[model samples]
Target: MRTTFLVIVLLLMRNDAWSFVVYDDSKIWNQDSITFYFLDGTSQQKNEVKRFSQLWQRYTGIKFNFTNKKPSFFNFKKFYKISFKGKNNESTNGAINGLIQFGNLSDNIIFRKTTILHEFGHMLGLAHEHQRQDRPNYLDNKQLVTACMKNQQQSRAWCNENLFKKFYKKVFIQSEYDPNSIMHYDISNITSKDSETNSNIPESLNNSLSFTDKFYIAMLYNPKLDKKTLKKMHKQDIREQQQFEAKANAE
Candidate 1:
């Protein structure tokens, strides 16, 4: 059973690594900039988070201000605090009174960047792309649920309840589904058995925001930008991103 459990963990870590789920009462930040305080993390870790979070600010009008000192009063209800307290990576789905946990990605620079980007996606009021109600056609629910339930790391009941609340729960906020969105989980082989199509789940994980991600974020934060201009800008961003990737690969 130990080997079986280990295999499950490896599959989960390599395949469909999870993200933070939003609370029922979570709300988007109505203001332009968000201020964050680190409850626990090294200077390097906080710096990496700040750097990655700036990507969102570049696209949307949202800004992240990281502070070393805590607020004078004990009112997390109005503040955003991050820490490495939880066993899993997660953050509140808005500016609610919640904590963002770093989990196991504390030392991994690449993964730390990815996880921070993902959690910040939540902090900006985005839900998991895979959890969109329209995702059933692309995923195998039974296989995914079974995998989560059988994992020995968490209780079966907790797994079932949490998976349902996270993945199965539907949010009508997004109109279209984006598999390559930074908000999506890396699911490779967890599709439904009856899926007639290949699903074509991306083998490579999303390290940066997709064009669609940028467009929607702009839509949410800066709605004044016309759709036509956003699309043209998205195309330009995509070209620049591809060039950057090519140059990085050649290095």
Candidate 2:
């Protein structure tokens, strides 16, 4: 009986092997300039990227001096590029996240946006939010256990509780867990089977940069960036993350 209970617990833990897919495009990102490469395809994605870029600049206080010029295939680090694919590049249960492909191109802007921020987070050397040490227990482990059983055909009857308790405990830090963070997902949608959790999701951007849907745009490249003050800025970010996590855990 003890063994069976142990097996059930192991199924609840999220897979550690999974991580945000990163490409080598660090050459262009700098304090003064950031570049994006758009693979020729539909204008919609390009438009979106352009719009998002403008928005991103506003938030990060960084300018993405982008260009549509073709880059050397051998030198990918020069610019961040987007292309479409014939099929999806990731498995997220139809969620608009992860590597994407459309036709010969595999760039999904939804995934691209998330990937960009995640990669940028890496560029900043911020570890995964789940790996943060100050994170509260926001997820329902039992639900995850059931999900593992349903998705992987793993028997919930046999899981390792200790493995998860030790590893999962530090999956978030005081600086990292914002739910409304463009970095985070809707708790229900991220954990549940629903893909449309975006319907009622709150805004990720704060009040000052609230006009544009993209918070990064206003935050970056703003002449008034100095006014906000760094201490208040980062503190608000952490507090918001905690609030979101708390709300999600309650649900």
Most lDDT-accurate candidate: 1
Off by over 4 Å in 1: 1-26, 74-77, 106-108, 148-174, 189-205, 226-251
- Root-mean-square deviation of every model: 12.2, 14.5
Q: Write the residue-wise lDDT of candidate 2 on 1-251 in tens digits.
A: 32343244335534442222111212113344445555565677566546534434544555554456875667533334445544322221111112223332224334454544433333322333332333345432446555444543445553223111223232111122444444333334333444242334343432111222122222222434444554455567457546744664576
Clashes, model 2? 43
Candidate 2, residue 43: the lDDT equals 76
lDDT tens digits by residue: candidate 1, 55-146: 78877676677888886685534568888666888887765766788866744455566689888888877777776544645354544555
lDDT of each structure?
0.63, 0.38
Best by TM-score: 1
Per-candidate clash tally: 3, 43
